[model samples]
Target: MKQTEAQWQSTLRFAVGVTAAFVLCEFLKWLPSFLAAALVAALLGNLPIRPPAKVAIGLLVTISVSALGAFLLSVWFRGMPFVMFGLLAVWMLLAFHKMLGGGSPLPPLLMLICLATIPVITLTAPAYADVLPIALVRGMVVALAIIYLVWLPWPAVQPPKPKPLPPPRETSTLRLALLATAVILPLMLVFLLFGLADVLPVMIASLMIVANFDPRAGGRQALALIVANFGGGMCGMLLYIALSTTPSLWFLAGLLFFATLAFGARISAGGPTAPVYVIACNAMLIIFGSSLGDSAGSFSLWVTRVFQFTVAGTFAVGMMELAWHPPVRLLPLRAGRSSGSSPGKT
Candidate 1:
């Protein structure tokens, strides 16, 4: 019992230290969202959530799917919102079906989708050009961080008791269809109203899927993301308004990036609730990047983005819960044989 307590303490310390380090790494060019993701993955793995190999494979699958989606959006649709969303839906369905055959790692796919969505949504706008490289680098950082952390030496503890897998529940296909329609219709209306029909769908779809279907602990996650982005955007706007006079764009970017990293780290220590920090950090990135272009236009763009996310998330969640009440089930595992009965049976 004492040893177990010590192990738990050690795990807590490691989690804290790793989170700090990951935040620090975000300041570096090669480090960012990916590193943060990896750290989270590692911590999760240690908790008997899933196997390390499965996690690694899932990460690779996510990267591949994301890259493919990016290509489709860039080449075929030129980032048209609705078109891209349609394609994304198809891709997600196919990927989900393939990866989760006979009850595989569904959560990882959702997690990866969330990770990939960050870049896809951010870059879908005309403002962010050639963002694929940056996104890939970020993913690498995350994957590496997770691998390292999971392998760290810690006291061995008994794995949690394997829960019995529940039978698959029927999803209300009609609800999903309705939800999709509801989300898409408003996005279309917004686009028509704003003359941004090309980009509105992408933004809305990304946020909707992320907040609704991504691996969330609870409703608090969606709330955190929204609050974080609002706070971050407000702060970023203030900073940009105050410092736009300076000609040193690189220096300003660097400063904001590091500051965001530190902030992200502090908030991430709060566990899954840390998405608020990430949202805020990304908000800074968008605001700063926009300021570099035209300060007059940046604020409007920021407001639009926030609004888009809000609408998408709200609609998605409402539709999902109301329509498809899919049951959550544990992954099935082969039971271990009893010591006495299995000795001579074979």
Candidate 2:
């Protein structure tokens, strides 16, 4: 028993060490210098809370492709709204194909599109260049951190149990698109109201995709996000207040790094709610100066953020349920196969 206890402690220590390392690396520069969202998406692609590898790979490819398409549309259509809309349609079609599969090489396809579009979009708005790089870097760092802490520990190697192939005669894809559209509309309104219109679609789409792949886990995660954001936000506010006098670049970097690490750990553990934590931590780091500026302004921003998340989360889950109606599935078998299984069967 004592030996077992010691072993458990050792394992925990190792996990903590890993988490700390991730935090330190992220904090080295105060802001992540990589495509943080993409990295996060990649990390999500491998978690137990996520879809099977096949599904995740598809989603990743689609998002990368779609993002590229959006960028290209912005450039080519510059002033033509209709052309931009057409591009969105084309992008969505390509994303669907990639996600659904068409015998294309996955990594190359994704990399090609993402690379092509990112530069075009970035160049279109020179002012965005500075902030965009920072956002991308931060996204990449967070993603890598999540990957190290969540995915590396337990890789997914086998195919998931085949879902009951959607009814032969049912039009599931159409239903999914309709559901997503419905969710997106209301979500857009809410975000616009909160002045977070830019991020609203991405947030809503992510939640919808995640929930579609695994509803129960997604639901739990949605709740986790809400709670985490709330807690993290409160913590962020406190930290900001406590350290306001000493707000150096290093301090900001350290806070973001550690907060991100903590968020990643909680997510890995399947903690009750992580979104809230993520929101709170991010809010604290990003808006640390709000308090110094104006109390009303800070409070308004806080309220807006909370409202934005609430709207996004609501739309995500609601549309996911309306669209896919994912059933609860067990964790994929570990060690390659189930016990007493034959070579060909799980």
- Taking all chains together, each candidate's TM-score versus the true structure is 0.49, 0.50
Cand. 1 TM to true fold: 0.49
Candidate 1: segments with Cα more than 4 A from true spot: 1-14, 29-58, 79-86, 96-127, 155-158, 161-169, 172-311, 325-346
Query: Model 1: per-residue lDDT, tens digit, 121-224?
Result: 34444454345434544554464454455446444444444553543454433334434444444554454445552342244234424332422234555455
lDDT of 2 by residue, 1-346 (tens): 1323323332332244333433443445433222343244334423333345575556455544545444555556656745554544444444433433323333323433343334333444444534433434344444444544543444433233333344344445444444544544444344334543234223422332332333335456555544544454456566555556686656655654555555545433332333343344443433333333333645566566545554555556655654555566789776646675667764
Please report how far candidate 1 places residue 138 from its true position, in Å: 3.2
Model 2 residue runs over 4 Å out of place are 1-68, 93-174, 181-297, 322-346
Predictions in order: lDDT: 0.46, 0.43
Could you tell me how far off, in angstroms, the CA of residue 331 lies in candidate 2 after the best superposition? Answer: 40
